[model samples]
Target: MVTAKPSLELVAEVLNGHPRSISRLISRVEARDPECRPALAQIYEHTGRAHLIGITGVPGSGKSTLVRELALAARKTDRTIGIIAIDPSSPFSGGAILGDRIRMNELTGDPGIFIRSMATRGALGGLARASMDAVDLLDAAGFDMILLETVGVGQDEVDIVQAAHTTVVVSAPGLGDDVQAMKAGLLEISDIHVVSKCDRADANKTIIDLKAMLSLGLRMNSTTGWQPPVVRTSAEAKEGIDELLAAIDRHREHLQHSGELAQRRRRTAEMRMLKTAEDILRARFISRDDDIVVDLVERVITRALDPYTAALNLLATLDEGKSDDGGKKRP
Candidate 1:
C-alpha cells in the first residue's frame, strides 16, 4: 500500500506521470478522501486536453475486446491512452469483479497505455461517482486519449453522455432482445454506433438496424449537422479498427470545428456543479442524527402525517440550520 503524501508533493508526482502516484491519487479520489482535495483541485487545472471517449453497451457485447483492440490501433499513431473500465462491484468485497487488467494482459508492458479498473460500488448509470475525477488525473498526466468503458448495465447507462466528448455505443448480435437498447436510451445518446463481432453472420443485421434507427434522427445532436455513423468491427479478425479510430478522430475534429466542444464542456461543468452540490447535501443529511428522521418515519407510518408533509417538515428543519435537538444552531 502506498502511504499518503502531502497534497503538493502528490500533485507534483502525478504531473510528472508517475504511475504509482497516479494510481494512489485515483484511489484517494475514488474513496472521496477529503485529504486529496487540494491535490485534485490543482490537478483539474491540467485537464481538458485529453479526449474522453465513452464506450457503453449491454453485457456480452464484447466491449472489452473492442477496447483493447481500439487502444492498440490508437497507440500506433503514438497517442498515449488512458482507459477507465468500470466493472460491477463484488458483493462481498465491493471491488471490481471483472478485472480489465487481466483481460488486457497483452497490453501490460506498454508505458503509453494506462488501464484502471473501477468498481461501480452501487452507483447507478454504469459509472462510479469518481470516474470523471480519475479521467482528470489521467488528462493532467498528459494522455492524449481517455477511454471510459462503463459497466454493461443494459438501460440507464446513458449517463456516459454527460462525461464523454465522443460516446460510442457498441452492439453485438445475438444479445437477446434488441428493444432493451432503445429502452436504455442508447439510441438517443450515441455519437457513434459500433457493431462489434462483425465477423459473425448476424453482425450485418445489427449494423443495419442501428443505421435504420439513426435515420430516424433519434440522436438529438444531429441539429449540429453531425450524423452518427455506424462502424462495424471484428476484434478477432482485427478488421475495422482503423475505421473506428478514424471515426473517432473525425468526430473530434467535427466537435472542434463546429463549436460543439465548448457546448459539451459547458454541459459537463454544469453537471459536475449540480452533482457536487447534491453529493454534499446527501452527505450532510446522512451524517446527521437519525432522531428527527426516525420520528418523521414513525409519524408517517402511524398515519399522523403523510410522507410529503413529513418530508416538508424535515426540509424546513434543515433550512433553519438547527441541530438534532431542533433548537441549537449549526456552526
Candidate 2:
C-alpha cells in the first residue's frame, strides 16, 4: 500500500542514474496507484522518444544474443540501451546475463545500458501490464533504445509487437515450420524478420520460406510502411550482426519518414488510457459494497426482479453512496 505522494526529487534522482533510486522508481510506477499516476504521466510525455524494439521468436532462436548485439550496436551511436528480458526465456537471472554476448560484458560498467528481467506474474500479452509502465520509466530515464524480449513460442512472440515501434521476429534453421505453422498470430505482426544462427545448414531454406509466406500475407491496405525484411545473423560467430543492426536502423528511419512513428505513439497512448480505465473501474466497482451487488444478483436469478432493473437499482445505489452531495435518482 503506497500512501505517500510521488516525490519530484525521486523522479529526478532516478533520471540522473542514482543507482538505488532507479529500481525504486520502476517499482513504484509498476505497482500502479494514483500516487504513481503523476509519475507515469510525466514518463509517457517522454515515451515517443525511445525506439522500442521487440525481439521475439520460437524457443532456442538466440533472441538473447541478438538483443545484446543490438544493444551493443546502439551504443556505437552513443545511445543508451534498455533490455527487458521476460520470463523463463533466455534469462540468466534478474540481473543482466553479461556473458550471453561478448560486448554485453564489455560495457557492464557503463551507465549507458540498463537491463531488467521480467516474470509473467499472471498477465498476458507477452510481458506483464507493468512492463509498459517500466518501459515508460526507462524511456523517461533517458534510454534511447528499449529492447523488449519475450518468453514462449512464435505466436506468443507477436504480442510484443503491439508494444513496440519495430518488431523483429527471429527464427532459425531448426525452427523450420515457424513461418507456415505460426503464421496466424506472430508472423502477421512482424515489421522485421531475423534468421538467427545462420551458420546452420538449413538457414537459407528458412529465409526463403519466410519470404514466400510474407508474399502471401501482405495486404493492399496494410498500415505498416515497409514490408518486413529478413536478415541473417549468427551470434556465436558474430556473423551478420552488422547487417541485422543496419536493418533495424533502416526500419527506424522508415518509421520516422513515413509518419508511422507518430502512429505508434498514438496507439500506445490509447492502450495505456484504456487499460488504466479498466483497472480503475474494476477496483472501484469491487469496493462499492460488492456484497450488495452479489446479493441482489442472486435475487434476480430467483425471478423477483429482472436483471436490467436490478442493475439500474444497483447503479442508483452506487451513485448515491459515492456522492458527497446528493445526486438525483434515476427513478
Local accuracy by lDDT, each model:
0.85, 0.73
Least well predicted 10-residue stretch by lDDT in candidate 2? 94-103
How far in Å is the alpha carbon of 15 misplaced in model 1? 0.6
Q: Which candidate number maximizes TM-score? A: 1
lDDT of 2 by residue, 1-331 (tens): 1224254556666566565555766666555545666666665666567888988877678888788888777788888998777764234433323233343566567788988766655556667667787787788788888998876554654557668988888888876566777788878778888888888888889988888888886784266658788788887778887787788889999989999888887887787778767666545656664477788789899998899988777767656665853522211
TM-score of each: 0.91, 0.80
lDDT of candidate 2 vs native? 0.73
Give lDDT: candidate 1, residue 276.
78
- TM value for model 2: 0.80
Runs in model 1 lying further than 4 Å from the true structure: 90-96, 218-221, 322-331
lDDT of 1 at 52: 97
